[model samples]
Target: MQQPHDTPTLGKRAALSIAALGVVFGDIGTSPLYAIRECFHGEYGIAVTESNVLGVLSLVFWALLLVVTIKYLVFIMRADNDGEGGVLALTALAKPKQVRMGTPSWVLVAFGLFAACLLYGDGMITPAISVLSAVEGLGHIEPVFAPYVIHVTLGILVGLFLLQRHGTAKVGTLFGPIILVWFCVLAALGLPQIIGNPKVLSALLPWHGIEFLVENRAHGFVVLGAVFLVVTGAEAIYADMGHFGSSPIRLTWFAVAFPALTLNYFGQGAHLMANPQDAFHPFYAIVPHWALIPLVILATMATIIASQAVITGAFSLTSQAINLGYLPRLRVTHTSSTHIGQIYVAPVNWLLMICTVGLVLGFRSSSKLAAAYGVAVTATMLITSILFFVVARKRWNWSLPAAGALTVLFLMVDSSFFVSNMTKIFHGAWFPLLIGGVFFIVMITWEEGREILGAKIQGLTESLSAFMDQVLADKPQRVEGQAFFLTGSYDRVPMAMVQNMRHNKIVHSEVYFLHIRIEEIPRVPNMEKIELERFGSGIYRIIAHFGFMEEPKIATILELCKGLGIEADLETASFFLGREKLILGDKPGMGRLRAHLFLFLSHNAMDAAGFFDIPSEQVIEVGAQLEL
Candidate 1:
């Protein structure tokens, strides 16, 4: 069941464009802080020569052009699931069905879920690293403030996390103008150096990238560890595409953000080449001393916006995961209806706050945190590219040769970055890997637990209509109104429904066997609404279709059903929901302790009346058997 409210239109295209510029561009916008500097001057405590600088800059530029502008913005974003984008949205469009009996879609979903979990690790690290790096600029001004850098960084991060509940639309409004000014300032400071050393422009040529790789060989490959920082937020672009349509994101990048970023990076490279001896930060060297404070403030704002984007992304991803059944349903609060993307999750927000602050404290400098930031982002990107290829050929009906050629080129570039970042695993990159591993375990456990429970229910379930006939024949009990039975499967109704009719001496004029299926797509078409099949003797089997992006509201659908000529009165309908209380008598695979704990947790879960949007007055709960 879904509610149809007025889809509040975002202002005009221009305002929507500005909003997109603010919210969607944060990840890519903050890259100028360290992308070029780290590539030229290795974060691994080594000096990078002039030759490697051109090559690294070339790699960053080309990676953005090929991967971000071409692959995602131009192509992948078009593969939206009813105007939504992301792994889950894509999965919905694909409609991945189980290949075998034991095999559930959860197995396939785990891959994307793992990627989502890894993004959480990235969300935690991005803020810590981005803010710390910007604040570390204070060190260049005076060494005395260095001691309190971590303290200030942590405080700002904590404040940002707390503000998430307030919704980003208020704070987010300033992001576009702030980032616009920051990029302009970035290019303004660096333009003079680019004009002086025009040869640095030669880095734009593809051969320069090749030459750097040929000459530096080992070091050139490792440059990816740092180059990855440039595109760390590339996935955010695709993930946030649903917020502001695909066209806006494409136009925003090619028209505004792209050229500004390129010039700024070139400016940074030009500054480094001209004044190799200057101890001044090349990023700040372009700016005058009088504007240093203002520049730092702008940088801080941009970084905060970047952190906020990832935080919002985590919330959206968690919401999607819950709908897809990879994770248990957690409490979700919609921050804004006008902007479906604006959401806040209590557990996710708090956990991110703790992890982010811990990272800031542990790795006080952005340089140290940078090593861990790119790995999770790059790994997710590579995985996305792989999935994109499958989608392009199989789903999009693209020719194999064309898809293969496009996929191979992107994979080489992305895989190189992934391997490059892999070298930094021991040097703090292991943090994201550790987080991803832990999250993967949680996803798998929850998924496995559901499978076992589903199987247990399947074995115990009895045919509702047949059992009803037998109960009526034996007991002849009669009651008023319609009875709705909830079951885990659509194939057969639960035994509880039959037992309740027989033992409790209750019967209704009509019995509706309801099966609610949540689809992977963000929205369901009107044609695929609710299907009703009458099973004789006033027994009707109703199957309701709900999209992953939709919140299931059974009452609302029943109201909608009135228009289709099937009258369902919620006030008179008695809702019968089965509750499986597990008895832990030594389950074979999941040991007694784990089963007992799982059973305890499952038993205490929110009742179906609230979860499924049924009125409390019309609800009837039946406790059933569960062997674990």
Candidate 2:
């Protein structure tokens, strides 16, 4: 995913493809549990006659073909930014190196950011619906189990969130095998019904879907809001492309996931056509009585794996946002030492848990939650299409006509789903909009506040060259030990250095100004990470380059410096970090309300020593008040 490391042998690709089943396909794989039932028995129910059944199945088939298969796997996945895919990664790809007025880049970037925020909405809804739908199967086992569904769901969700700190490495090994079994069961359960009625196979033709929309007119159009659920996790496939590489994901999809999903959906339609009375739960109705309990248990495990993938994705997304300066610093714990992508964001995990539990209590059924599912996904899909258009033009250098043509095709599909989803705004679709709006505001505020603060500091500070020239000319008294001043800008004197000169009145025998710069790419190779410059008189400047996915550690930086010929003993060194307090200056560009919010965020932000993993006893905090 992070650009090709090597040409993987066939055996390696096969293993990665299998492992990807757990993480990459889990969300889409679980769609069969509720997608079919929601279409026929949901708020926009259509009749389950043979024609209607095949028609609906046809729509699902084509949507999978057009959106997930053609659009994402073929086109959008190719827009990966250095082999990283996702709205945020795509945004970085589409963002122009230079800003120009009247260009559409700004709009594209803004839309992409909002789309990224909407994924949080997806994060909250997916687990609620997936786990809730699976747990509801208990009712099939016994009528008495229906009453305890909510309690059981809440308990499962709580337990899941609580277990995040322990990491996923322990259970991750079982994810691929369990999801494989779940998909197999999905195929097996639906196959008999499908085999019994070959007439349902006619749904593979495109005309059935068109006739479905024409026969029902506007009613069928609205039903698309439900049908959109089939491709709800398509974005996740693109997002996780960086995890297993696109080759493995593409191979697994067509070879394993696609066939099973296609068969199960056809099988469900066949079952529905024969026994329309069981339309409320055709998925469970297709299963043999003897396999019901085991299937439900397997289904529960599969859904949990689905939920776990989304939860961990939220953690990884949060980490990206933090490193990219879209969000404030939060505690990020790397769960797997071997797997760079396996991470834990506790704050994000707990917040998602609270929302997931609340959603289950509010909707109380997967059918109602289905009303809220597609709006965020469709909007995100639309945004991804727009961004992909930009990347095709700017990065790929494709012809304008060619890029526009493909985008138009994608837009037509995305627009239809988004407008259809708009009809459900009153019926619980408002949840994602409200949540995404708040997150968008926070992201915009954080970015704007950082820029304003940087400008303010720039106006009050001296250039590094000027400060170094003056210090060498003055020849101030020097101390024995080394001093490393953590700085934000490479070519400006750190606030801590300025304050140290004003208050402490002496320079150390060895002075190193360190700045950590996060690059847009997922990772910066270690060999190119450290940039050093000598300013004479034992004073130096060290600029450390980190990728958005990499965490900066001061200890590691020092160790790397030692290898780069800057010999300094750790025991005799002290790290100086600037601590800023925000105050509204006369030229405060931010509105009063946003300024206050930024103040609160800055006040509670993780300190430099903690975030950088510096030794506590060796860190010295230098404080200054900054007007924003």
Candidate 3:
């Protein structure tokens, strides 16, 4: 085997940082399109006085530094699970293996799952708002283009979602260069304005934000719901850490994203200070007439890249949730063979597409969708801060005071934002919360339902050694071919095997009991992936270990077995799988509603044989009644 590589060279780091700008910064990169506009013209927006302009700019500035820079890039991004970041990884890191319900770890995991679910809502709203805001530029260009804004936005969205099937690996390469140009334009647009009204730079201080809040009093706090938009995509930075290592991401942010975003927002501030009436379209107003068309085009493409990042994030989180058993299995298509991170989930993609398009039609404007955007992300960030506290205490072994002090600081910021967004609960913000709530229910119900089903199964199945002894004593007719039985319980005989012995009264010449276990890490090494145990009389046990980011496949398991010097038949091997017929509330204790929901979810889940990539012709599914 080739030796492990050392730290990457500076040239490679620079390349990775540039690539990171595409996928990692895409969502946050496009914030300038609408973030500043919302703060001044949103429902609770204040008059665009110079001090107010400086104040709003100050708020946006500090939000990026404290929330995105200090809390996330400097801190939470360090909580990666074996080089993987995101709530899923944080959940695994914070929650130990085999933590029981009602424990702190268990509660944290549930919260983490809810946070993950909230991102889906964020995902749906992002594309609609991002693309609509960019496309809204057409309305600024000419009266005729204004009429077709919605139509053009819809067409682009449809095309974007349809492109998912072909995968984003190739599209991703173009994202870096395009986004790099977009950021440069943001900086360029802002520079001259800042030069003209350099006083807007005073907003860099914390006092202006405080004064703005004090002067506007209650209204200022409410407009914070809008100001939160500047940092709305902050979570994406941590979520994509696995794709680009943290160093390159941090480097890209401080070097490229931070400078560009700062200049643009300040530029917008400077422009607003001069032309207060342009508050409604500050981002566009700064554009030179000659650059307007090209800027709009770049913004639209940039927003598409933003939408692509979140959509892919939704896919990655969904896959991890399924593998970790928080959600039911779905059809996961690996879009790139070289990178496991590049995935396409059909159901997630279509669902997002429908919701996003519906949001555009229903909202009719980016300003309306903007109201729905900040709530989910603020709540998610709040949860992330809470989870980080637990991780620092439990994993890093930090003293309570140390953890509490840092956590209190984060919570103060998070709570302020969360409370501010709460005011808009009815003004379109309820949509994503409702979405998050429904998924949280689905996740918890499925987890509890599976536990109940496992308990029932445990009672029905006998010990493996005892079953083997009985089978040996019976001397049942040994079949001709190799047979594989997949089970969740490592030591208990599979229900399918039990059914086969009861009816067919025969065992295969070579019997393998296979149990696939998903570990908490992102990827399992091949050396420790598959473990085989030999039992006399042609019976064996095979255990396959996978990480939450990986799919457990039978072909891969068999290949590993071959590596271990256990060569089985290449063809004509039978694989036995259990087809569970769940009897809702048959054993009592579980609520009827949740039980029914779990049954519905289980029924809709993908088939085991197909999920594991077993040959259809060689698959045999034995039916069993499972009580929940």
Candidate 4:
């Protein structure tokens, strides 16, 4: 079977490109619905002036230009973790070669994972806020729809969430053309207003944003909270770069999406400036009465596609986390084998559905939900900016001066947005923070729990050389041929091997001490596959590294070892796996209840035989003790 990272054929590439236009562009594409309009006309107590509109638009335009275009498209995309992007990918890139237990590198990886857990909060809120806001446009056309809007939005959201299990292939075929037409229609709707009042184009000037910031200094800081919405999906550009190469996304943005979005936003600003009172539903009002219903339907479709992108993103992130050992293994179902990225996790899907529905029900309107949206995105963006700086200095080998300057610039922009969003904490933005807080706690607890368990195992472990000496001294029965033992930790020898040595008193002529290190990178290059160190007398210490994006199957590694002159026949090579049985004690930090729960969960985890894809006949499980 072909590996997951194999380059796509021409036909697959074409299909994926179309899907990219629809699914990938959804979140950013739907920004025109509220991002531009709300900047001047938000529910918050901010004044709407011509300069403010221009300034807000200027901010939006430059944010896209600086953060999305310059930072990610130009600089950060190159920081991809072996064709993958996002916090986990960055963690893999930044992970230290020689990890001391509690070093700064390990802490940074934990920080990255925390950022990822926080994204789940953003993921839930984005769909809720984006879709509801779009559907609320129906209330503008007919007042009767306003009463049932929340229910209708909830039903539609649930339906969309339900559709995830079926995969996006069939429905996704309509995304590219629909979004393409949506952008055209969006621009076309605003063209007359923009052309009529050409001054609206002045929003493109940076001075207007500066003036607005100077004049409305207090409220302008608050506007950053609303303005941050414009770039909510900016990180998706980098995260989804592997699906469609940086070339297509860059081309799509400049060639089609950017210009159209700018025109629509400018047109909206023009409509507001020309007739402020008439700007109540300027987007729909711009369309002819006969076309209003069709426009609403199109907008709905666009929002659904955007939600689909976020939902799929959650699945991909969760999978990456599991593979990298940050998360426990969950049931992962391949939604489409033809597309390795198309996957479904039932637990995650259901959890998101519950949270999203709860949000919609509680907030009741997208405007209310909007307050909770930007903070998480901004926080994640801030984390990305920090990681990118590291990538610039270490990976790209940029000078300290150049890297420091770039880092400062990004930090100013990202921190400004983060601080601005902080103003919304009391106004419903606290929801995502609460979600993120809970997730962060869970992640940290699990990580800390694992470390404590690993340390306990290390203390109980016996060295391979000492075990071998003990076995030879006993002088029992002697066996023949070479035996290779698989161990979880590099410090300890497998207990099964110790038992075998003690009983048989015969050391295999060639005993291999193998250690596998799965890196955080999505794809490990063939050149970095395996490293060998001779420990003397046919005893070789081998380290094999796999990336987070790649499956860690021994069979595949064995195939990979063909180049290293090592023949791995599973039937002949004994695979040893350690099973940790937790002994519950009075753990000081974690309460007795949590400790018991952790022990119960750990004990019932899936066996390594199936998880590691090793043959049952060739596998040996030795019980080890862990005190919690």
Candidate 5:
């Protein structure tokens, strides 16, 4: 039998590239439906004259080339942390090795966390906008369908989200074939328009775009808010890099997605140049009349795929957050037996569905939701640029001049987009800002609160050496079976062990202090998983390491302990755990309001036994109260 790694060939890579098409390009691929239309008819839209149309098209061309093609695909994708790419993963890599180094680490961490929060906002807006844009194409088929656009959009979105529980593996096989056809249709529909008026090709040069901005400086600046819509989903390419390696993502983008999108965009521009009256819905109008209805059906399917990508991304990000201790533990169900990353988070799923539907009902149109969409993505892009700068300078050992130069260019572009989208704050961009802000608060509160609670609790415990000597000084009744106490701090004795000795006055013949450590990386090999230290008097200390990508399972760790010469039986051994009930104090540490909030979070967090996969029948929970 051939090993998995030895089975690779060119065909496998090509297949992975095809699979990349369905999830990675869904959002940006659907941009042609409204990107060109928004340029001339959105809130900040300019006139539809020949010069203005070519100017806008020129700007779109370069934005895609520089921002998505060069900035992300060429540069940012090179900054992956241990094969994991995302705002959080990049932040973890960028964190300074020395705590006392220049530019405090907390500042970089804060920026990264805020950026992750904004992505949640993006997750909410993507489905609403992408699905609505696809369904809105129906309005062009018949004027009578205008009233039912929202109804149809909501139905499609609800049905799409409801299917998330079934896992993406089932339908993922069709994604490549479906999106492959969608891109072909985009190219097929746009080729004729591009050929009809070769003048649209003139917009390819940067001078046309620069001239447009110079001719209409103030209006052009505002128009960038609309123009930014074309590259809204570019970050998904980077966020999903771990799903399909950078090779496949890059090949798919350069070969298929980028070209099809550019042709379609230029085609829409050429169509407008020839017939300026079709500015209302130029994308569908460019299609042949007989193919309009079938095109709408295809577009709807593409949009659902786009929406599915974001929903799936939200689930993955939440799982990372839970494992990293930035959020409360929620019940995570692995939807696939083969792929550990294929997970269904019910709370995140339902919450996103509710918010996505509410956004559709509230905004009522893709154009309106577009106003709220760019801010989150732009903010995330800006933060990614910043984090990338740090990683380039610190991790890659790049010289100051080289790192500073490229980062400054990226920052300048990102800041321009950020400022342009900032103009729409009052228009409708407040929705994402509000959502990101709420999530940011919750994440920060959880992180900071855990640190303070850990410190306070650690202060109350004695050192492990001292506790061991005390136990030696006053010997207790020794039982036959082994006992394992799960603890957070390895330096201090676990509260469960202390309470057990105080009440029962007995210790197991073999007592093990097991500390489960979640590392910053994605996965840790099983060969390096367990570290054992035997203290005197039949007391042993074991530290088990797991990556953020691995679910911590106590039973697995216990089974592995046999290799280290520790005798254990799952049927007879007992696992001890501490359950803390947080009490809010009138002190000024976290303040009363935040303290009470942490208390509530602690009370509802998943118990350790369930989260660590410890069997309930072989567990003992000792309850205690801690004041914060």
Candidate 6:
């Protein structure tokens, strides 16, 4: 049954906002650690000067305002899918029920898929960069600590991933407080610097940024790729809407996050203007010498919180993909009894751990990873703008010109950042692109392979009405117990039922053809959850509707069916499921390489009985081999 999306009560709003600090703003929150430093020391870095500092500060200010504040906060967050927001949710909102290949709708789906793929790329880098950058603060404490930086980073990352299985319910409470203090400290540290160099406030003006770009031109454009780092987690505001409602996120950003980040960035610029050599490590330099170690410890905690948020997001995205059939199902264990969205996928967790650790050891420094960081996010932002336009026009009833104007403005900003980041492709930017490309291929292959396989399996089914008539004519012996045969489509006779009739020569007294339909929305209402059709002669068709955010529990489904006047006794019921074996051949389908890839994926996919929480002892699998 579809349940209404939960909304925090007025009293809980403050709490939710605090929690938002840890999850939604962590990545962007940690940017102050290295953003300004990168602009002067990264591979594409320029000299630190008065005008350059002002220009970079202005660029950072405006990028946050335009890209994050206006684009994501004020506008795009509204394009939610039943209170769930993300690239995939947006994809679901934009996709039509019947999308043919090579159509605009199909292209939109592809765009969403690629955006999601980029998120996995973003997911891998976020933890590596956030944690590494945080731990790198130790080097600022003492020159003696410099050599141990990589070892400390690897240890911290390993420990973090190891804690994933136990779930974050216990430690999660600390996230809000830690991140809150982190942001508060950011403002406290930067406020004094901004006051010292009051002229830095002029960066609030767009002309300074324009002048920087106008003067520096190509180099300034490249610097934008670094500046883009400040708003890297902007998508989190939208992606995590399902976890914390939009109101809390918006409130937290405007009230706590936005002001704190602005002060920190401007403070870094102001400090840089005063002491140019400190550009080597401006964020740590801004702090008093006595507080340096404490700050580093705090920064490490904040970064770890940030990494946890991204890892959780990866879990959510993968769960959504699996439900949508764009990826194979994996074992999903709910981490919290109170929250369905809080889950841990073993495969996703370990895969992310390997990649994140590899990145830390390879890049060796946060500044290096910064080179590859912004591309995937900018690409995702660009794609989001495009999808938002589609939703604005079709779903929101906005006029084409109106949606086009708003989208074009976002596109211009996103495209500029995307192009700037493009220059970093040779300087370690290829990593995310390669990761995104591999994930995109896998997602598309799974989706297309399912279609091909479903088509072939579909052809093997007999007409339900004809098959029933034949059974009636033959007067087959009736068994005592009820039998439920799961089928892909409601009108088709299940292959399991067909095979059972041929082998056993008896039909159960009460038989049901069960169809589970996974809907695009996050939740389906209970009234519309189940459709029970009595086809007569003890044969019935049962369709259970589930939202993407939900997992189908046969016990719950059967109970709901009973409530709807469709009798079901689970203890005596027999469940029949189909097991398809793929054989690569010269058939008119996918290529042999892809066919084998699909087979490998299918082999690893979680069994349907376990996925649906069916009783393994009561379930029977009817196997069939199909040439693809």
Clashes of each: 0, 0, 0, 1, 0, 1
Q: Which is the better candidate, 1 or 2, if ranked by TM-score?
A: 2
Residue 600 error, candidate 3, Å: 1.7
The lDDT of each candidate is: 0.75, 0.87, 0.89, 0.76, 0.86, 0.89
TM-scores for the candidates: 0.92, 0.97, 0.97, 0.89, 0.97, 0.98
Question: Which residue segments of model 5 deviate by more than 4 Å?
Answer: 1-8, 97-103
Compute the lDDT of residue 588 as modeled in candidate 6: 39
Q: Residue 267: error of model 3 in Å?
A: 0.3
Return whichever of 4 and 5 wins on lDDT: 5
lDDT of 6 by residue, 494-571 (tens): 889888888888899899999998898988887788999887778999999988888877887898897778778877
CA shift at 489, candidate 2, in angstroms? 1.2
Candidate 4 per-residue C-alpha lDDT over 231-347 given as tens digits, one digit per residue, 9 for 90 to 100? 888888888887777666776777777788888877877877877775455566667788878888899888898888899999998888777665666667778867678898887
lDDT of 3 by residue, 560-612 (tens): 89988778754678899988897755455468888788889999999988888
**Candidate 4 residue runs with Cα over 4 Å from true position:** 1-17, 278-280, 470-486, 496-515, 526-543, 558-576, 588-597, 600-605, 614-620
Q: Cα RMSD (Å) per model?
A: 3.3, 1.7, 1.8, 3.6, 2.2, 1.5
As a whole number from 0 to 100, the lDDT of residue 216 in candidate 3 is 92
Worst 10 residues of 2 by lDDT: 1-10
Model 2 lDDT tens row, 456-541: 78887899889988897888889988999988888999898899998988999989999999887878888888999988889999
Runs of candidate 6 with Cα error greater than 4 angstroms are 1-9
- Native-referenced Cα lDDT, model 2: 0.87
